[model samples]
Target: MAWFRNLSRFSTINVSRRHDPFLLSSFNCFSSNNINTNPTIEKPSVDPVQYSGLGPTKPHEKPRVVVLGSGWAGCRLMKGLDPEIYDIVCVSPRNHMVFTPLLASTCVGTLEFRSVAEPIARIQPAISREPGSYFFLSNCTGISADKHMVHCETVTEGEQALDPWSFTVSYDKLVIALGAQPTTFGIRGVKEHAIFLREVHHAQEIRRKLLLNLMLSDVPGISEEEKRRLLHCVVVGGGPTGVEFSGELSDFIMRDVRQRYAHVKDYVHVTLIEANEILSSFDVRLRNYATKQLTKSGVRLVRGTVKDVQDQNIILNDGSEVPYGLLVWSTGVGPSPLIHALDLPKAPGGGRIGVDEWLRVPSVQDIFSIGDCSGFVESTGRQTLPALAQVAEREGKYLAHLLNKIGKAGGGRANSGKDIDFGEPFVYKHLGSMASVGSYKALVDLRQSKETKGISLAGFISWFIWRSAYLTRVVSWRNRIYVAINWATTLVFGRDISRI
Candidate 1:
């Protein structure tokens, strides 16, 4: 994390560079209570109407655009926008945008840990390298609609303390793209027991725990039963994330754990419990293929829901219990604390902030929301979009174009929802889904494309596609090489099991 802290030194914070740096142990999610009500910040003096392209503007004038979170949506908007014209400020807890697909690989050591995380500061050299554009890592507490300011808190660990931890980020055009968090679904003990797979720290923690379990199994005082229990890994939720993590875990056990602890090879077990069929989101045929592939790779598939997660054991809905050393929770995402804290119009069930075609939060015209944090209401039957990286990425690109059009047109404040329509409605294309099973096999469900014409592929070919796609999908050149090298190393030497 030294490099991570170092990346922010070049950003436009006016604070002194003398203080010690530390990664906030896990993410510090700031609720309204944790944030100070008032903080000192630079408010924009330029006329909003002229800066927003509604009125005439001088050559030197710039709009204050504040984007929350450095996930796909926030980063994409920053990358595409001309930072020189707009004074951009990014606020988030994490300093990097994790490549989620390769996160599973990092857990089992197929890829290096650093390969999956690209520093947020490097996302856009144009803005990140600018004199005043800042990509600050802080917790977004609340939005003051009356004052047009975002309340933020910077919480850090270790001995050295930072000055003025709480502050305000004022924006002329605001973007609330703070992404979602792992949902326990109100299940008992899940937060207390299970490990989430949402961020880089989660993957690092998984690796640490897995290595510890392996080493503990080899201890002399441990009985065979204890060792067997130590090898029981349970994965909840059968989505692509869960399936991909399960596959990587199986590969780790079969290749590394088995060879290292041959005596307990038969005892090592990986169980995947899903309320519905595994890979239910995929086409039926692709789902079947995934099931077959997972079964062949020695992963136990359980068709049930997890009622409760107790220490060392998970109680299923049917009263069955499965003991586990590692419980990786891959259940679907829910609204983040920031999202829940918002007082805005939401869907009937009340999960995400409801956004119209222009991705504007209701009642707040200048404020826009995107990514998993915002629940999109599509034109077609009011269908809610899934919380995927692809969806967030697409939404980011569209918002950039929307804002740029308004800026070019010299628009001002929206009088009503009808006034904000600068271009065509936002459209989300179904790109397709893919999951990797162990032993060089994968399942891919592609929508109608020029090449595939809507095809479902499985086995080695799909696996190859999976690797190639993710290899190129890495956001940075350094990360891409790191992943490629890690993959090559994994192929020749197997996954690294060292805990530290």
Candidate 2:
């Protein structure tokens, strides 16, 4: 037993024969003698077991690159990064990245639930093990900027509670793409009661809840008022998410749920509540078109700030109260507490980090901030970039190009570029926007000169265009196919409302 233990201990030193001559000779002496002395034996030079944890360190992998969040900015950054350049790892609780624009369609079964979600691990170049790329460390709670470390909570399989897990990763560069979280505006009961539309799980949960409400309402013992309360759905904030979700809910209720359960046709109600005018950012014609389409679809529109959100009711700032079952809060943006916690150099208006036009934090050149969390000033330095997906996407591409230049330049000169030197100082190209109303009708706001405006199409044609555009925009072919099949099947039949 002692000799066996010694032999096992000797195996641990099998790093390199040149490094540990003693153990190398002990094993090699036996093997070489057995092979060459017998002349009938052939020996292999490489053994994976010896090199399992003892292989030559491959240049320390240029330090493990940890990306926080798998949202638009994070995913785009992962996609854009050259695998040969840095060892990449994406950290987010979600395994799949939800294509938010197509998410509303998924909720209504117009697009299959699976179609709109691209697995984070499956994006192109397949970040899993492409050269210097690796994906691990999913959950991030906080970061230690001084130490250049991230504090995370992880759990084992089937574990009920999360336990603290720590890993110290030294990075040559850090990209803070944590993105923005849902803002409740200090409104009571919003966080506890309402469901947000940011992630795939949220969408799935909404679908499940809607189905459960539908089925539970049909239960024999439930009262009419209970059914009404169960059936009514109110969506707060008339931004793209809120409006589209409302439209999806309306479509599901009118087209599928009503058809399937005729008894609840009159009971189902969806209200879109916006603090300001609905889709105010869009062209007035498009806004009016969306408002009109929503109104025509039996979906009610309320304009007021949400004063308070109760479990069963919403109190508006105007002192009006509306009863509801489901509440979807999509009011506005706030800095992700993750970013806010950094307590770094902040600009005006609530600690928002003001970055230069090139998207680098003024304090730290290596730390680049983009997306909603960053307030990047335009060339005139008068207005800031709007917190839109298009803006984030453009910023991401700009950063990628800049990083590519950095890679091309190499060495000390890589870090010496002015904010405005990147051609234009983040000129936002308005590529137009689109929002669905219900069932078939949608308003496409083509604000670009190259594109036309007020393209309203209803029924199958609009639906087809919507699906095609979104599917093309989905991260990868795998997701596109998954979503396409899901949409096709749902179109032919219906949603599988059964919960797991």
Tens digits of per-residue lDDT for model 2 on 198-277?
A: 87777777878887888888889889989999999999899988888888788777778878888877899998888788
Tell me each candidate's RMSD, in Å, in order: 7.8, 9.4
lDDT of 1 by residue, 1-500 (tens): 33234233332222212222222211111221122234342221222121000121224556667889898888888777766456667877887888888788888889887998988768877555565466666788888766677777665666754532445666677888888888888999999889999888899998898888878887788888888788888899999999999999888888888897776678788899999888776777888888888888899999998998899889998999899999999988888777877887675454788788778876675788999888754432456678889989999999888877776555422222244446787888878888998889998888633344578889899999989998888888998888888889988998887889
How do the predictions measure up, each by TM-score?
A: 0.85, 0.80
> Which has the greatest TM-score?
1
- In model 2, which range of ten residues has the least summed lDDT? 2-11
Q: In lDDT terms, how accurate is model 2? A: 0.66
